[model samples]
Target chain A: MFQKTLTLVLVGVLFMGIATLTYGTFYDKGFAASVTGMMGLGDDEHGEDGDDD
Target chain B: MTKLRLPKAFELLLVWHGLLVGSYTIAYLTAEGAPVLHQFAGYSVLGLLAVRLTAALIAGVRPPWALPLPKASMWKNFGRKLAAGHFSALLGRTPFAPLSGLVILGTLVLVTLSGLAADWWEWEDLHEGLAESSLAVVLIHIAIVSFAPLLKRLNASRADAAATALPRNA
Candidate 1:
C-alpha cells in the first residue's frame, strides 16, 4: 500500500514537472522563444543541422 | 515474475507517456506557434498513440495476465485515489460520457491526420484548427489515462478488503 501510494505521489509529481516544463517552454509565443530559444532547436529548424555549408 | 509483466508494464507506460506526458506536450504544442515544432509534436503524438493502441490490442487478444485485465495486477497497482477519481469521471457520471468521449477522441485522431496534411500541403485552416482544438482533447486523454490505473487499484483493494472483512460467522 505504501509503495503504491508513494508511486502515485511520485508519478503525480513527475507529471507535474513534465507539465511545467512543457508549459514553460511553449505556453506563449514569446515564452516559447525566450525559453526554447535557449534550449536550442526543437525540430523547428528542420535540417539546419549546421551542415548547410 | 511472469509473462504478464510485459503487458502490465505497457499499460502503465501507456498511461504515463502516451496519455499524461504526451497530452501535456500536445496541448502546449497545439496552443503555440511554429508549424515545424507543432508538426514535430504531432508526429510524436501519433507515434505514441500507435504504440499504445497496438499494445492494448495485442494484449487483449492474448491472456497476458492471469487476471482478466493485465492492468489489474495487485503487484504493480499503486497510485493515489485522486488519480482514480479522474479516471472514473466519465464512467461514474453518465453512460453517455463514454460515447461523447469517443466522438471527441475521434476528432482528435482527425486533428492529427488533418495536421499532418496541413504540414505538407500547407492547407491553412486544417493546421490552425486542429492545433487549436487539440489542447482540450489532449487534456481529456491525459486525464483518463492518468486515472484508469488508480481506479483499477481502488476497485481491487476494495474487493480484497471486503472479502477479508466479512464476519467470521457470516
Candidate 2:
C-alpha cells in the first residue's frame, strides 16, 4: 500500500519537473524578459526610473 | 549474499540522464552562456523521465533491473530504527530504498520548478537556492550508493553478534 502511494508521488513529481522544464526551454525569450524585468534589469525604454526628457 | 544489481537498462538510462543533466547544470554555474544547449539538455531529461515513468506503470515488461520499490514496512519502522541508531541495518534493508528515491525525485522537481521560475519570473534567488539543494541531494545519493556494501557488512556483523550472545545465554 505504501509502495503504491510512493509510486504515485514519484510520478507526480516527475510530471511536474517535465512540465516546468518544457515551459522554460520552449519559451526562453519571454521567460528571460520577465525575469530581467522582475530583477529591475529592464533597458531604458522599459525602465521606470522616470527621467524621460 | 545476493549480488546488488539494478536492471541493466534502467541503470544505463539513469547514468546517461545523470551525465546530460549534470553537465548542463555545471555549465550554467560556470557561466558557459550557452542557453540553447542547456534547454536542449533539459528537454532530453524530460523525455527520459517520461519513458521511465511509463515503463514503471506497465506490468510484466519492466527492464532487467526493475525499479527498486521498497516494501510498506520500511516507512512504518523508519522512525523507530532511526532513533535506535541502527544506521547500517537501516541502510542495508530493501524496504528503506524508497526513501532515497523519494528524496532524489523531490529535489529534482524543486530544481526544475525553481529554474523555470527564475528564468521566466526573475526568481533568481529561488533558482540559485534550489540549484544548490539539488547538488547536495545528488552527492548524498551517490555517497549512499557507494557505501551500501559496507553497510550490508555491518548489518551482518550485528546479526552474528546477536546469534553468539544467544548461545552464551543458553
Candidate 3:
C-alpha cells in the first residue's frame, strides 16, 4: 500500500512538472506567475514580468 | 552476465539527449551573447528530459528501469538510514537508481523552471544558480556512469577469483 502510494505520488509530480514546463514555454507570464505563487514568492515585488498587466 | 546494459532504444535516446545537453551547456557557459540560441537549447533539453522521464515511468515490468523511489515511510526512517550509512548503499544499487535519478530529475526541473522565469522576467539570478547546480550534478552523474562498467568488471573478476580459490565439491 505504501509502495502504491509513493508510486502514485511520484507519477503525479512527474506529470505535473512536465505539464507546467510545457505550458510555461508558450505562455511565459502566466507560467511565471503561477510558479512564483507556488514558490510563495508571489508577494515579492520582483516577481513576474512587467507585462503581467 | 548481470552487468548493466541499457536497452538499445534507451541507449540511443540517452546518447542523443546527452549531445543536446552538452551543446546547451557549452552555449550556456561560453556564449552569453547568444541568448536566443541558449534559450532554444535550454527548452530543447527540457523537452527531451520530459520525454525520457515519462518513458521511464510508463514502461512497466520487462527490462525494469529500476527507479528506487523513496518508500512512503522514508521520512520516519531517514535518521536511522543516515546513521547507518545506507545512503551510499542506496546510490550504488544500480546505474540509474532512485537517488541519482532524483537529483537529475530535480535539477532538470529547477533548471527548466528558473530558465523560463529568467527569460520571462529578465532575471538571471535563479536561472544561473540552478544552471550551475545542474552542471555540477550532471558532471558527477557522468563520472559515476562512466565508471559503472569498470566497477562491474572488477566485481565480476573478484567473484571469479573467489570461486576458483574454493575447493571443488565434486
True contacts kept of each: 0.01, 0.00, 0.00
Candidate 2 lDDT, tens digit per residue, A15-46? 43454344544665455643342233434342
Backbone clashes in model 3, listed as residue pairs: none
Model 2 chain B lDDT-worst window of ten: B25-34
TM-score of chain A of each: 0.49, 0.49, 0.54
DockQ of 1: 0.08
lDDT of 2 by residue, B1-170 (tens): 88987655644555544443444343243222334434454555445555555666663345533445654677657666777886645455544454566576566666666656656897767866776677787677656654666666777999999999998899
Where does candidate 3 chain B have its weakest 10-residue lDDT segment? B26-35
Q: What is the lDDT of residue B25 in candidate 2?
A: 45
Give Cα-based local distance difference scores for all models: 0.50, 0.53, 0.56
Give candidates' CA RMSD values in order. 12.2, 12.0, 13.9
For residue B164, model 3's alpha carbon misses the true position, in angstroms, by 19
Model 2 pairs whose backbones collide: A35-B122, B7-B65
Of models 1 and 3, which has the larger DockQ?
1
What lDDT does model 3 reach? 0.56
TM-score of each: 0.44, 0.47, 0.48
Give one digit per residue, the lDDT tens place, for model 1 in B51-91. Answer: 65676577665532111232333212323333565444433
lDDT of 3 at A9: 41
Task: Give the per-residue lDDT of model 3 (tens digit) for B1-170.
Answer: 68986657544544544444554453353224334334555676677677766766786433334334545456446556767976643334343434565687778877787888886696588787777777788777656554545566787899998898786753
* iRMSD per prediction, in order: 8.7, 12.5, 14.5
